[model samples]
Target: MSSRSVIIDNTDAQVQYSPGWQANGSPNEYKRTTSNTETQGASFTLKFVGTSVAVYGTLDIVTLPNTTYVLDGGNPFPFSGQPQSQIQYQQVFYTSPSLPYGEHTLVGSCVDGGGRVILDYFVVEIPLEIPTNTSLSTPTSAVPTTLGSKPTPPTTAIVGGVLGGLLFLMTILVAYLWYRQFRDPGRRRDTKPSFTSAEQDAQTRPFNAPAMASSSYITTQHDAETPNHYSETPRHRDVISTVERHKSPHVSLQWNQSQQPPSYSM
Candidate 1:
């Protein structure tokens, strides 16, 4: 049920009332009404309870030779000038209590040519009202007439500087962590990768890929004189076989001749 309003005219403006300025939804909270006779326009804002339910409005008097004015109520509040004035503009807001719910309505009206009040535009709204507690009104200590007021902006600046410095330090810390994790990954991994004996041997040996393939395709040759050792080519076997074959034939013929001599004696 709290409200705020503004009064406006051609050159002058002022805020008439704001119900949410203090205790919000507390019943003890009350709004201070304002009145402006100046020929200017003004703006007002309202918040119900302590919640964000807010309403704002601007009021301006229509320029006419003579007219009385009255305002309307609903979603956005509406108003009309006296019958003498045909055009007047005003804005208003609406609020409700409980639940985070709200709505807005911009309703207006004007006196028609029939001399009857006619609706120009109207809308409905239901605004949420948050609960609030009334704050105690404590009397402020009187300021010394001689001493000037100190500005709080410098303290705010110092606090801001401290916050900025803390944020910068935090950013640096985060970047360092990221660098350790990604750029210097060994340290971040913590544990070193272990190599088994077989793996280590494989890593140390020179990999002759083509030589290995050739060894597999070619036949293995062995030395006849040293059967335990390996040889490089089939020529080793060929040489040994040729020498054995020639020696065998010569030995057999000598034996045959020796046998024949013995036969003559018989």
Candidate 2:
């Protein structure tokens, strides 16, 4: 299990004191084992939940105070103040070995009245909220559920189906158009559009809209006449001149009813 460190001051309520234990010196100097004549039967106990615990205190070098600590009601470990050449505050008096990560009780008592043994503070190593192994459980199921989510719709199939339906509709429309064109011959217009003479002349002659030659709807004042082309009349004699008088160089005359007359000289 992972662990964290904690600092516990001597004045904290977590420390339980017996009758003969009293605050000694300034608060920084810590609590000391005391009595009217003897330091025996004086003790302080603490209950903590952690992996291990260590005790700290201030001690006088002249008369080394004898002390011991009992953990979890088990074997006693020495917490005695040792003789030193110089004065020191907040010194480690006792340290416990690695213990089970759970609640444990610790008791500090005076072993002999050599001098006053001070109790300054405690340092504890505690287990984290979760054990390393417990937090590393399997996460396979949750991952797929989160990333894949609900199964994706069959998008490719749906698009293909829509396209297929449109194609079917287009095929039906084409078939209907084909039937209309072939089944009823009247509906089919194979004959080219007929154009009026004026319209034909306008196209072939490249003329801006030509004037109509005649209006069939208009009434005529005189009856229509049919001319004899081979018969000579007064107008024909005037046009021919006397054949005996002269014969000029002729650019032969020619006429056709449906086509334009050729250029001629008389």
Enumerate clash totals for all models, in the order shown. Answer: 12, 0
Candidate 2 — which pairs collide? none
lDDT by residue (1-266, candidate 1, tens digit) is 44222122111121223222111111111111212222222223222222222222223333321112222243333333343333332222233333332321112222222222211111112222323443322112211111111111125567899999999999999999998878666644436656686798999997653212122122232323455544323444345545544644321111112212112233
Give the whole-model CA lDDT for all candidates, comma-separated.
0.30, 0.59
lDDT of 1 at 86: 32
Q: Pick the candidate with the highest lDDT.
A: 2
Model 2, TM vs. native: 0.44
Segments of candidate 2 deviating more than 4 angstroms: 27-38, 132-266
lDDT for model 2, on a 0 to 1 scale?
Answer: 0.59
Per-residue lDDT tens digits for candidate 2, residues 1-266, read 66656666666667888877666545234333212112786888888766688787666666666788898888888755557897676677888899866667899888777467767767777655645543332211111112112222236777999999999999999999899878876555657755786588777884344332221211111112324442323334334433312443232332223433334468
Q: Which lDDT value does model 1 have at 26?
A: 16
